[model samples]
Target: MTSKLTTGRAGIRRGAAAIATAGLAAASLVAVVPTPPASAGVGKAGASPQVPQSPPLPQSTQYSADGWKARPEQYDGMDIERDVPITMKDGVKLLADIQRPTRHGKVVPGRFPVLVQQTPYIKTVLSLPPINWALVKRGYVIVTVDVRGTGGSGGKWPVWGEPEHSDGKSVVEWAASHNRPWSDGRVGLFGISYGGINQLFTASQRPKGLKAIAPAVPMGDLYRDLVGKGGRGYLELAPAYLAAVSGLGILPNTNLLKDPATALKNIQEHWDAAAGNLKMIPEMIQGGDRAYDSAWYRERSPLTYVDRIQVPTLLMGGEFDAFQRGTPMLYQRLSAKGTPVQFINGPWSHAIAAIPAAGVSLPGVINEPPGVKLGELQLRWFDHYVRGVPDPALDRRNKQVTYFENGANQWRTARQWPPADVRYQKAYLSGQASKGRPGALGTPVSGTPDTVKWNLFSGLCSRSTFQWLLFGGEFGNGPQKIPCMTDNRYNDQSGLTYDLPVRGRPLRFTGPVNAHFTVSTKSRDSQLTVRLEDVGPDGSAIQLTAGWLSLSMRELERGRSVVRNGMVVQPWHPYTKASQKPMPKNKPVTVDVEIFPASWSVQPGHHLRLAVQTGDFPHLFPPFPQLKDSFGGDVKLWHDKTHPSWITLPTQPS
Candidate 1:
């Protein structure tokens, strides 16, 4: 905290400084205490080591706690150094909390590899996941730095902008320098969500001394993966994001005056400034603007500059993670360029990405099953790169993709994404959902056409009971919001359901799902939503993945699309304003929608269902207010030979 650093925002009050210091040390739920583990000494070199049990964590924040505690901290003799100041190249000073191995209330004498995590979330509060203790005990120095504008740092918080990136490089270089205690000048990056995204962009700069990064459930593109999807903004989620960041008060004007009483006057000033910035966030994200691929959005997206990353990386997440789309694309781009990288997708959600393989549930509210833990794998990765410990298993695992297949509830390794053995199959759509018989999915049986209609007022938001993972807890207790796996019969009644008859044998599916349709509507523009569901024998429906496309943004760049095994894996679409076209009355138009990727197993006798609807409400604002009521009475769909409408599944052999 002593380093002389410039305050980039407004001047800070020195006495007001004590406010942040007190906040960091207060007994609020967010306070982080780096409690040492059971004193278990290490065995001989290469000897079987005893697993260090994680210290008891607060139950309220168990998700974040368990996330940190999921992995055993092998090293028990560790100590924390709080509020260390780090100077950025621009002369702005950031704050960091370091955890290092210690003995007899003193630092252990040794140069160890460093792992840096830059977070807007308070570094001292959220830094020590249970895994960091284990890492420190195993001879690593873990530095959790508060990004500019947040924590107790001296600067205007710029969020994920250039200031944060520049500060990140400076922090890494400083940690790698010889002056820091216990650091060997080698650094690796790690974090989840916001923490994870910072790592990706920071590593893209390829700062001196940065050796590797392991980002879990990171948003590859801010516009596409974070604020919106398929060119549409997440109306409800965007405001929620703003509220959470504002609640943190992480970015206050830090320009401090020397006098204590004078400094207190600036507290209100800081509050006002923070509030103003929060107000601007919605506009900054273009939350209400119906524009895609804008220069403002592109500048905030890592997708545009990801090619600059040169460090080895481990992209990790759950199959159902909110940030799922971006990671796979990043993995593919990096792998194709021969940058050392690996991807691990599991059956968990964004909150529990780091939960241990043996899941723990707390009472009736929190029900969790065994999940993939990255602690051990991370240790191995850093050990090899930072400590010179060669691991053949890491090498082999990286040669292909490693993911946990849901339904099967087991981990599977594949040579390529979608797996090399995947067989993409198409199921044609037919019949009427409103009819008692509903619709059937099968081979073209007579090439007959069918139609179903829903008024804009009739559509219900099909969010299911699943709480968004990002909104859930951070570490240990895991997300209190488990995806609602309950029967969706009631929900299916709200949309058009096309069910496949009972399967003769178990059908396992992996990777992305595609839905192609030929439809016509009287409205000038509309939104067509498609959802994948698993129908059990009892008639209960398990919702799977869903896809959405604003009718106007349906123009696809087919030639630029990615095709695998003659099937479109990722269809490139020009969602820009220029490519937008209106739908003419009764004029059939072909459209392709890419559903979210998934790994699910349909048991024998169970069925698969494709639910199509005009729109989903609340979750997304129904088109623009001006176009909300433009359903134009009725919508029509065709399945004749001339217009074969079908849903494609990426299937794996039984």
Candidate 2:
């Protein structure tokens, strides 16, 4: 069964509003404190796109962050200082909006710690800045800068290049310096998506007075996390993301009428920058350094510089986020270095995490333990780190990590991620499976290999659509509201599945997953996706984690690939042009697919299934050359004695 979405006025509006849209991240729109909201001036260009408002949370769902509560709002409102210019080292003046606590029409006396957010999206049109005025009212000065080449800021956008990194550090220093009278000389960085990702780059620079950082739903490895889903460009979402930021960057600056010359220059620079980025998409479609994990990708990936970030960090990720594969990687590196860090992995997607549902619940999908409001959690992080205020609750929080384990349906905290007791286990796929029916997992039988067709539209209404679309792609049809996106049954029916029945206690698995397969295809090339899902007795398939691999780029970075007790738990592929090679048609080749990490407890009656399919474009997001190269073919998965296939899973001893 193929997936389809009914597009209409309501659906289209919902889709557009839900995109990260550069300016849409950062504001916590939860049940806010009862006060006249601190108002900030909207940019002459326009206000940020508004999302549908979620209703108030039920009292039972309200969460307290380990007994941590927000500091009292000492001010009635906040006053905005718009179009404030901050000159960078290269003489480019980036425009910023400063929001300071105010009463009546006067600025409050004395200084407050500065909180900085650098956005590629226009700073002035940022969505609902006033909604965050409550944060300013709590004794903090908030500043949001339009990253170079966007908004009123000068200089060309290098697309997350050295210039942006340098600018990030320069901006942090500017906010933390005494040059700004309102600044208390201490700084913390926060934002979502673009705003959030830059914090890592800036903090890695180790600017003075930088205290802490909390990057919500940010990506560490750009190429692997956002650009390249497996070994190809993630066109399913990357194109839209690139187009949005670039297109919005070149828009006319409404606040620049007073300075026509500067405004024209800004537009010209942005147009050129956006053009240069868009040009690379075509190059990427054809195989080149742009398509591979070359220096271009490595230089911009925040993970490359994570070792240098010394500040206390709070990283938030969704189990279903685009960056799910890399958030834990960053967390692990930070923890290994003994850097103060906390990680929260929710069952949310990027959009849900950015503008959460009322009470942390996503309607009928899953209800989260409404923990401390998201904004409050960020406040706590900033207060403890930037403000230097001692909080016993924070000390307790610093020692633990939080995660929402689905299926178990509760907030679970551990001293470390994946819990130390988790052991790597393997479930082998059986060779004896009938045509058009699912096969059994474990205790392999010597029989014929299974086959699957190369079908690009296989993953349409699955979790991948919801995940890749960055919103609720699960809502099928206009007003008909079929819950097909969340259910993997539609996808599984079209793929090859191997299941392992669960008995006695619930078969729980937590942490990274891998699918090691030995296969051959009718064509010289093929791209395949592996999905680890929970199959209920009612025949419902809930995708837990997924991985992708193109046969051409199957060479592993031996040293980087993770192995435990001789089993490859996490396989790392370089995805470089040099590593990419055409496959030998109809020849058996082994592949190790790196599935994203997740913590889920499959209830007793629910069996675990590993699924594989190819031509899933909406999720695979492969570039044109790769997609075209592996366009159509019949692929075979061998599970006979000599060519056994299996999945490596992290499970705890019962």
Candidate 3:
């Protein structure tokens, strides 16, 4: 069955918000914090938008870096310093807002360590959060800046380029040297998404006085994470992300907010101004020859310079995030270099991690999940690095890999990723695709070839991206509200599936899933997408994780590839213009697919199933549409001893 489109109120609201008018110059930066929030609520003057009241947050207690319990509301109120200017190496001035702890009007006397966050999403967006309040109460000065461009900050954003690196360094240095009364010269970086990306850029530069960084759900490689994963552009979400960035142009100017009323006025003005068009940014990026890793993508990606990062880093990822593969890769590289680092892979999605429901707060927005612990985690990391506080949980001398297992609903820790104790178990594919029984995965089955047909535009981004965008955060839809795969019956019947025998006991698969297939297609070029599912006795299929490969881009970088149990850990591909070549005519080729990493426990009575198809629509643009590509006919799959096809699961020993 084909996917249906739902353009309801959310879609209409998003459409209205994304359309920006022409020739609106960026707003001017005001040099002082607006007078304290007005005591009385006020309405808008003229047609401007009405000011929004501060969002309400439930009263809650949080743990300090050194493990102390304290409520954010009980802490000393903060002193606000807005639109402060910091000059960069190139003389560009970025605007920043500083919030420091205060007791009865005097800046808390002693010098304190500082926590910095830089974002393209106006700095004012974070001004009212208890998240910042908690940090300031813990005796840390919080400085939030508008990353160059987009927020009264000078200079163009360069879309995540060198400017981010240079500006971040300057900001860290500025926070260290300028806070004579309130800071002792040490600073740590933190933020989510673009904020996370900025931290990576700054840490790579190794700015002096920079203590450490905690980047959540960051983009490790732009091309791999967004534009193209396995050589195909992730069409739907990429454009939406670009549109979100463009919308920032119309957001209320944080530097100009004199009070909540004034801020609301500005917000309405901007929203009203964005009524005609706002697709320019995304169009420009996608309009280029984007089939491969173009220069624009490489320059913005942190994967190129991550090796230079030397500071202690805390990296976090959500199992369902659009960019989930990133943090794990960062963890692996950092650990390989013996750099102090910690990694947490939770069962959240991009929204859940970005706009957390608990412990964190965004102005006028509240979707917090009760009893959240990420704030505590962040506090511990900063305390260990900035304050030199001691805590076994954040100790660099100890193992620090942590993951949340979904089916089991439990957290597990390991010294290294994928937990070195995992052993690879193989399940071979066998069955007649046309005969109607789901293909079976058995122990080294010897059989003839089977064929399956797939149309590229069938599924909807695997339901992860849409879930995050429409919902406030990843968990916005709540448990049982949004599922990764819906029912899976139609999809499994439409494609090729190899079902494993029912399990007699529980099985925990804690790492990457690898698949090897020997096949040939009549089509000039074909893309292979592999999905892993947990099938219950009732035949319900739950998607675990998936991997993709572009047949033409399958030339592996032999020296860079690592092989274990005959499956490449990460099949390294050149994906360069010179390395692109069509598959041999009707000749069988062996291709390895490295599925995204996952942590899941399969219970007794459940069986594992593998599904292979040529495309997952509205997620990644199909290769056929761009190049007018199509398979010659039914794609042939070989499974005899001469050309055995199997999948290797990283299972933890029982």
Candidate 4:
């Protein structure tokens, strides 16, 4: 088998001066070598060069035969390594490539703590080598271990964080005990996405010598973040994640099944089967026993242990990432419980973490934060916490809850999340042709419309259905909108729009979102969809967050539901079996739609837009395919001084 490194649009190249300085500093690190043979010849549109296959090294070897070594040419005077395997207690051997200064035979005066990252993404010889080398030169040991069942490890793959955390904990302990030159008892964990979540899981367990963790773009809840809520799933995220993981699971030298050919075939077969039966993958992968049968899923979930986390943690996520809701929940819980947590978020996707976002480009790769610099941040974090370095950069005062404003490229930080002193404002949705203006009043009422009716047949199509056709079928073929809105053409009022003008200085909303109104359906049961957006000066609407609720399951648990800002706030609650009670048709009832929590700043000129439709395409799977009693034939929203319809927001006071 042959492998090559492609310096695509994403790879970073250092200047001569930087390389020379790195070389001198990394002299005591691991001996440097040329770019790993795996990264050589793999370029944009270029075929990978063939290389001889060598026998697997024995477990007794301190590092894999292809382990971390210096590569002078790859990075001027930098040391590099690749495919170093480490064995864990459960006989699950994992691979990690190390990069550090070549030990100059003299006892290094002080032992440096290790910066560890465990991810499912393959750390190719070229991709992460510079990062490791940079850390080594900076007097730190950098270890990049592939998570269990992904790269050179034994075990069946469970999507997301579960098994990875266990593997990470084991690796941290092993690195501490190993007799390597820089192997001190202290360890710091860092990474993005699955890599990020693992840090949280590992830290929550409060590992013996674990000092600190930096989990960027970290996922918070599994079921809510991954599956769906209010009986709907974020269609695109689940399938895309499964596809990506399937690819990662088939990487060379990672599977115990040995031959990449056979492994790829097996993975493809499983993936194909999964595609055919989407609902069964979770249960099938989990196997027979319900309790702990899916230990991986249970272990990967941070919600299972949020109150237990004690270490100071730095959590980051993207404003639009699938797991955005989870980050705040995790941060709030840990911080309020006095866990010393800091949160940072940006407008980045998962892939951008390892490639630089500005200026430099790797031929075919998306610009992500370069692995080398991310490693440096990890080093600084470790230096301050593990080594007690007293670096001003790692001081608590310098770190806070920072986020990116959609239109603003600059970053903003606040002492606390959901900033304090935000005013809760109300806006009424009335039916009228106002010509794009607010307060175009129709008759306002204190309760829902007396004879509000909607056609049940109209709610058949949804965002999930359209997405299924787009990505799974033909619509995904050509150039499409990058952040496309899910299609909802079949539902009533599909093009419905609502606008609320800003009343004061740029309004910053941070916290749970709510839409409150009295609703009545022509049928016994119905569904309602609500969306929140920020409308730009040019009339372009950017979706901030959304929510949905099935009236049938509107039974709220005691103490979990609160009425605020004219809307009902439903805290996180597990779904319970549906009740057998029946309701009279055409009766008016109060319903609260709770959207996901988000942080967004509505500029002075921009308007807060709320679009109310009976359906949200692709955002969720339609409650029932049969369309039996699902739509409320006619619906009326009442808003006025007495029954003022409004959206509640967590406002931070300036």
**What TM-score against the true fold does each predicted structure earn?**
0.80, 0.88, 0.81, 0.70
How far does residue 166 in candidate 2 sit from its true spot (Å)? 0.6
Q: Whole-model lDDT, candidate 4?
A: 0.50
Per-residue CA lDDT of model 1 for 52-83, tens digit only, reads: 42233222111331232223333435566666
- Residue-level lDDT of model 3, residues 518-626, one tens digit each, is 9887766677778888788788787778887777777787577656765676666666556667777678988877788888887788877788877766666644433
Instruction: Name the lDDT value of residue 355 in candidate 1.
Output: 36
The candidate maximizing TM-score is 2
CA lDDT scores, all candidates in order: 0.60, 0.71, 0.64, 0.50
Encode model 4's per-residue lDDT on 1-654: one tens digit a residue: 222222321233544223322321221111111111122111122222232221222222122222222222211222344555565556655656654444342222334566677665554422243444444545555666666565444455555445555666666765564244345556777655666676777776666667777776566666556554554444444555555555555545534344555445545544453454344444322321211113444565776777887877877665555565677778877878887667766654333332221112344332222222332344445556776654453465433676665533445667666655545655556544222333322234343332223333332344333322322221224222432433322232443456666655776776677676666665555555766777777766666766666565455554655455544554433333333123346565656677776667778787777666555445543334213556444455555455456566665443
Compare the candidates by lDDT and give the number of the best one. 2
Better of 1 and 3 by lDDT: 3
lDDT of 2 by residue, 180-231 (tens): 5566668888777676677888889998778998877777787888777678
Candidate 3's displacement at residue 110, Å, is 4.1
Query: lDDT, candidate 1, residue 575?
Result: 67
Alpha carbon lDDT at 636, candidate 2: 89
Q: How far out, in Å, is residue 43 in model 4?
A: 39
